[model samples]
Target: MSESALQSVIHTGDGRTLTRSEFLSLINTYNWFLKDQAQLHLTYSQQDRDGEVTVEGFLNISWGVTMPIRLQIQDDKQTPPSPLITPEISIPVSPLESKRGMTRWGEYSDLHQIDENAETPDIIISNVPPAPIPYETTTLRPMRHKNTEQEAESNLVRCQSDASLVKMRRKAKTAAQREEERQHRFSINGHFYNYKTSIFTPTHGASTKVRITSRMSTHQVIEQLLHKFKIENDPEEFALYCVHQSGEKRKLCNRDQPLWERILQGPSEDIMKVFLMDREEEEVSNDVAQYLNLELPILEQVLLKLREEESKEIQRVISKYHHQHRLLSNVLNCKVSPHIETSV
Candidate 1:
C-alpha cells in the first residue's frame, strides 16, 4: 500500500489520530499477534529531505492476516507531528478451512449389516397377566401453619374493619361540619359585579345582595364573579375594588385576605360596593371588545325590543291623527251640503 492510501484510510472516518503506544495497546488487548515469520523491512536511504524519518513494517495478526504499517518520526530537535496508524489491507481475516465434506448416513450402513438368513427360529408362549403398578402419595407442608395463617387473616380483616370505621367517622364529622357552615352566615354588606360584561355601567345598573361566608376571600369572590359573568379574559387582568358611600374608591390590594376584614374597615350603614376593574389600559380595551362580542346576542335582543316599542308608538300616533281627521271631515261635509239638501 502507498503512503497516501494509508493516510487517507487513517483520517477517512472519525479523523482520529492514534499514537504508537495506543495503537500497540489496542492490538494487544484484542488478542491480535504478530507472526514470527513476518519481518519489518526498513530502508534508511528513503529518508525525507527534512529531519523526518519514515519506517515501514508488516504487522502479522491472527489467522495469517498481514497489514502494512508506516510510522513517521521527527528528529530530536524538531517538533513531532501527530502520530497516526493506518492499516493498508482493510479485508477481515477469513477462516483457514471454509468448507468441509459431509458424510451421508447410508454410506456407513454396510458396517452394521444384519444376517437376515440366520434368524429363522420359531417360538410359542402362553398368555401372562401384567404386573400392577403402585403410586406413592406425597403431602406438601404449608410455609406458614394453618392456625398462624388463620390468625393473620383475622388480624388483616380486623384492621380493614377498623380503617373503614375510622373513614366513616371522619366522613360523618366532615358532613356535620359542612352542614354547620352552611347554616352559619357571615353578615356582610357586599355586592359582586364584573366590569368586562357590564360595559359603561360598572355596577351593572344596581348592586346585588350577596350572601358570602367568612371563609370566602376577596380573591375567591372575584373569581366567582368572573365565572358567573362568564368573563373570558384572564382573571389576573381584573381586580376587586371597594367603593364607599362617601364616594371614595379604594382598591383591594390584599386579595388573599378574608372578606370579613374588608367589611370591618368600612362604615356600618353603607354597603360595601366591590366591583371588578381592569389592571391595564390595553387589557381594558381588549376586554371591552371581547365583552361586546360575547354580549352580541343580548344586544340584538335589546335592539329588537327598542324597534318594537318605536313601531308601537308610531302606530298609536297615526291612529290618533286619523281619528281627528275623520271628525273634521264630518263637520265640513254637514255644513257644506246642508244648503243643497234643503233646496232639493
Candidate 2:
C-alpha cells in the first residue's frame, strides 16, 4: 500500500486530527484493521499486500466459517477524501459460503443411503416387535457396579447424560436492578448513548452543560436545567422549548412524556436546539414590540411636558441675558449714564 507523508494522521469529519493512540483505539473499536497495524506486525510483508486484511487475522479472531483474509492496500496520487482509506482494506474477492445446503434428515445423517429400486420390497412391520439390534457403547469396557469394595470402572469415550441437563431458572430482578440497567450504558457494555449535552438558556442569554437521560420527562429536564443555571425560581415557571432552523419553536407541554422522544419526533438536533426560558416571559417577549408601541403615546406625552417646562426656563434665561446685552451695547457706544453725571 502506498502511504503519503501524512498517512499516520487521522482526520475526523469535523476537521479535527486525532493522536495515533486515539486513532488506533477507534480502529480497534471498529474492528477494522489499520494499514499501520499491518506495517507494525512482524509477519507483515509487502509480498502479502495482495491479500485482503481482516481484523481477526493473526489476532486469532473468527467471525464465522469463512476463508482466510489477507490485507490489501490501494494508492492514489492525490489524497483520498475519506480518512478510512489509510487502513487500506477492501471486501472479500470471493463470496462467503455460509448458507444452508440441500435438505436432508439430520437424525440418520451418519446412516448409509437406502436403496430406491423396484426390486426392493417395502416391508411393513406392525405391533409385532422387531429383533433387537446391537450397537457398541462409546466406551473401551462396560462399567461394573460401584457397590463393590474395589469397583471396576470403564470410562466412556464420550460422557453421555441420560437426560438433558435441567436449566436453572433465572432469578427475577428487583426494581432497583432494572432501574440501574436502564440508566447506565457504559461503552464496554455496548449501548453507548451518552451525549455531551448543552442546555441553552434564552432567559440568561447563555448556556450550561447538564447530563440528562433520554428517558427523562420534560419536567425533569426543565428542573435539571434550572438547577444547572442556578435559577432560584420554581421549575414550573420555566419551560423547555425546541427551536428549529427555520426559526420555528415548539414547547414541550406534557410533563410526564419523554423529552428526548418528543424532540426526535420533530426535527433533528442539528436542525433544532433545546432552550430553557420562563413560560410567562416567553409569551410576553413575543409581543414585546407591540407592548413598546402601546407605551409610545405615554412616552410622547412626557416628552411634550418636559419640552414645555424647558421652553419656560429658556424664556427666563433669555430675558436675563437680554438686559446684560443692552447695557454692554450702550457702554460700547460711549454713551454715559445720566445717573453718573454729578460724579463726572
lDDT of 1 by residue, 122-166 (tens): 334459776785544445743543488777677763444333444
Q: Score candidate 1 by TM-score against the native.
A: 0.21
lDDT of each: 0.41, 0.41
Put down candidate 2 lDDT per residue, 1-344, tens digits, no spaces: 23442254533322345444554454443333334455322121122453211121111100111121121121222332322222233334334323432223342212222222212223355799888965656488785434543332332212222111111133565444466555432221121222232222232323333445433567876665544333345666656665554545556674443333322233234555566654653432333333344467887886799899999999999998999999999897776644444553
Query: Global lDDT for candidate 1?
Result: 0.41
Q: Candidate 2: how many backbone clashes?
A: 5
- For residue 246, model 1's alpha carbon misses the true position, in angstroms, by 3.0
The residue ranges of model 2 lying beyond 4 angstroms of the native Cα positions read 1-205, 256-270, 281-344
The residue pairs in collision within model 2 are 51-70, 52-70, 52-71, 53-70, 53-71
